[model samples]
Target: MKTLEHIPLNGELPSPKGVALAILELCRKDDATIAEVARIAQTDPALASRLIRQANSAAHGGGRPVASVTEAIMRLGMGTVRNLALGFSLVDQYQNGPCGQFDYQGFWSHSLLMGLAMQKFSNMTGAGASEELFACGLLAQVGRLSLATVYPVEYGRLLDGQDGVARNLVALEQEHLQTDHNELTAALLGEWGIPGALIEPIYHHEEPEHSGFSTGSRPYQLVHLFYLARRVADLGLAGENERNACTAELLLLGGRIGLDAEQLGATVDDLVQQWRTWGELLRVPASALPSFAHMSAAHAMRDEKSDGAAALRVLLVDDDPTTRCMMEGVLSGALGHAVVCANNGREALALAVETQPQIVVTDWMMPGMDGLDLARALRATEWGQTMYLIMLTGHENEDEVSEAFEAGVDDFLVKPVNVRTLRARLRAARHYVQLLEAWERDRAQLKQFAAELAISNRRLAHAAMTDLLTNLPNRRSGMNALAKAWAASSRFEQPLSVMMLDIDHFKRINDSHGHAVGDTVLRDVAQAIQQSARKDDSMCRMGGEEFLVICPNTDLKAAVQAAERLRRMVERLRIQAGETEIQTSVSIGVATREVGMTETDALVNAADRALYRAKQAGRNRSCVVVQGQMRCFP
Candidate 1:
């Protein structure tokens, strides 16, 4: 992919300067009086009116109407006041626009649904970052709106191709604008001086799984909550196909969030109800929303596909004509599929293979090759894979049933099988078959889809963690891989090593040749390092001229050898940039995991110390950290 040029940063939207300043100033002081904050909020008349209206809403349960701003402020606590102020400030900033292709009201309604869902989830999980979640949800798509307002032509072009698009728009934005919504939003929030913790979710909302924020990490979880909430909200706007896609995604993510099928269904029901009420409050028309009735029906249809209470196919084998007829009537007329009968075990085997019956009800004492022999013969063939063999035993000894099991019979039906017992057994067999089929199909499809998604996600993550020009893993991937290797080694009591390398006098190369030539040298050096490392080892470009290698199950001796090899490989590699051949050499530092070294920082620190030693000794060599001391290798 070609690199995208940066968009010029000078554009003005509706500035809520007065409101933003008031909210920021109010939040800044610990000793500031409540009256003083209220006085500041009162300066913005629009904000004050909105606050008064919200205070009287059903959500707040402020039964007695408060006519004055002062009365409202006194009734609501400080935290609520602060939240309201922040909400109003955001509304003032983003509420107005030409929004030619974007539906502002619809966006806000969806955002409101997400906020409600996040609040509910927070309460349920004891996550307790609802206010920040609400704010992030509200502003999650602000980047799109910003682009529409600022870059109208480009936005129009994008909108022209927006019909039934399934790809992530943030990725599209990054492809065209060199910046995604997450990055833009994070930058804007930082510019507005919001806390970094709150800004993180805004920056990493689209790809939460790879955001390096753990579920226990407040910012990461909040973003994940918002992502989930938005999908739930989308249930109100999606078409049938889109809803199915969203539901599948929801179910896939449910296990990660500790929700069972029944619990997830209940949560979806609650979200639907909340979405309806919230839509009404936001003045969004019912026609524009995704209906709860449709979603419920779709969910029901999906469930019916795996209900496992369907009809069963039974194969009845017996010598007596009367007994065979009676069993056929019970299985086919009372149950479902036609029951095929065979007088002997030899005949039954032929029928079993041809009919591929789900369950077999056969007499133990039959004429020629009895039930035990038939079960064993069936088990030896592919027919047994689908059939649930049930032997009819006249003898009730436990040892007899053990012989039946040894012959691959699933269950024993004693002579004169009762109707209720027969029905229950058939049902159980049907359920087992259905579950097996469903699992097989789901596993195959999910594995294929997951493989494709993993590849795409890995590329995106690589892009996020790599230097585009150098084609090497960036600082983030380097650090992350290093940390991961360190943890694995510590946990398993295995050897681990890290190598940090830097190109000697890289700036001189850039100055002597042009930056384009410098880029060629960097790429050549990266290729050399990549070729030097083992397949399992990780090679990363840690900004500018520095690189890092994470080697698992490698001791200090092996690590030094690998680092020296990489150093020599780089020295030998030559880059031709516009007819100028440039040769480069690298200095390397190697550090291995030691006893009592459990943390990543310690390993990195050791490698850094060794790197400094390599620099202090002559350049273009390797140094190792041993027993807290640095030793240089010639």
Candidate 2:
């Protein structure tokens, strides 16, 4: 509800000089290659030592020796190298003095846990971009530290208020500084020129919904991951009451992530152990961490209470005295809820107003106000907004059930309702209510988290198969699709076609416009390619600007037609950047598979040759590779 300008940054927070320097140096064009970056990092002996130690840590499973800096750079790749450089640079930033009430060591340990958890989650879900996510998680709460370091007094005041720290911090930050940590951290990251994807989660971790990132965006998911990590940290730091709250919170998050109870338990255990190990490795004291075992046990006990207690209030309305008594007995004695009984619809309405029960069970053909009439009345009331209404009816017709639902009934209980059926309905209603409550409590946070998580996971999955900047399925996805198509073609004995395409002089485009604009162009081209391909056909972004399209159940002639269509589409793609409208074109390489050959590599290789010929005979054309011969398009 607060504006961005309201939250101000405290001036006293420690300057992130080392972190800033490291980020600046890493972002430079001269430090572009992993080798060059490593050479720069090696200039700092302490950083170099830590990098080597971390590379050989148990986490990386270093059985073979990573003897030199070059080997570490080669083994880990550019992303990891950059992350290590940045991480080690900030390690010493928070190593001294109490920044408000924040225990720096404890905070760092928590950050480490979150980083590991994010990585583990990526691995478990087959999500891509684990390293980027890890970096985001590690720095997710850097804003808080920044605030503490900059404005210790204001932060101390903000923390001093225990009643509503979450709400109060936002208000206080806005009142004094005109910017909160969330925005400040984002600004800092932007200043350092970090990738937009990574910067997104850091800035929007707290208020994910309003961050302008789409739902199912990678940054949103990272936000959720960070929240979960923090919750895990809270569980570690919790007392009995806080532990109970954390348990409930975890259960709610687990449900959102589609983790069943058993899976959730296992994940928590693994995360706790990993946190402990990482804490020791980082020299973070044990006292800083919340007792994992204690929290786990407490959470388990709370979960048992949540499962066993049937505290839901139900209103039972029936004309028959015997039926009313039986329903009351069953709900009260067996199910354990405060069951309120009313003989007819009229009485039920009055009692509903008084009791405000979560579920309503009434016989359809009551005397004064019938079940339908009562349900209608309840639906019109404020109390009825969320209450689950069930009608008891003898009719089993589809129309009857539909009418009941239309009249405001959520479910139907047949006349002579069995105990099992009634119990199941009640259990379902309870679960639904719980979910609704959780949804309301953290709607903004959850929505943002879900979106970011989806995007990141999808991007990672896509990355394995497509190009990063282009947002197309990567070569990996292409290969997988090819294999699937091959299997299907072999099974059905159907024809198949494969096409490979490359943007003409993509490097020139990058050189002409900045790489950022070039990235936008590549993305536009990929979108054009996606649109050109048939819905069933598979399209993948090969490294650089090259792309591959797999057309299942198509002959060479159809493949060529498809290729021409794609070429035209690319030519039509006019990208706009401010006043400039940039035009681009693509060259096509087509190959087809007939009978006997089942391998995908051979088909792909054939397409490559066609693409080569298309490029060789001037740009912006289509060519086919058939029986090992390249034929250029007219």
Q: Which candidate is the best by TM-score?
A: 1
Estimate the TM-score for candidate 2.
0.49
Those runs of model 1 whose alpha carbons end farther than 4 Å from true positions after fitting are: 1-5, 8-37, 44-101, 126-128, 148-187, 194-204, 210-220, 238-302, 305-344, 347-358, 361-366, 372-428, 434-634
- Give the 10-residue window scoring lowest on summed lDDT in candidate 2: 1-10
Off by over 4 Å in 2: 1-69, 98-100, 125-128, 162-167, 191-193, 252-258, 286-634
lDDT of model 2 at position 462: 52
lDDT of each: 0.72, 0.74
Per-residue lDDT over 1-634 for candidate 1, one digit per residue giving the tens place of the 0 to 100 score: 1111244443663334676467666666787676777787788786677556555543443389987777776666555566556554655555546646666666666666776676667656666644444555656665666676766666666666656342456656667666655666666555545557767765666667667664356877777876787787676566676677777777756656888766776777776676566456445433343344456468768765544333556788998888888888878776665577899989988888788877888989987899888888888886586678888777789888888888888888876878889878877777777777788899998998799678777767767877888787788878888887777776788899999888898999989997888888888888888888898899888778888899998988889889988888888887886777788888888998887775888888888889889988998899998898888989
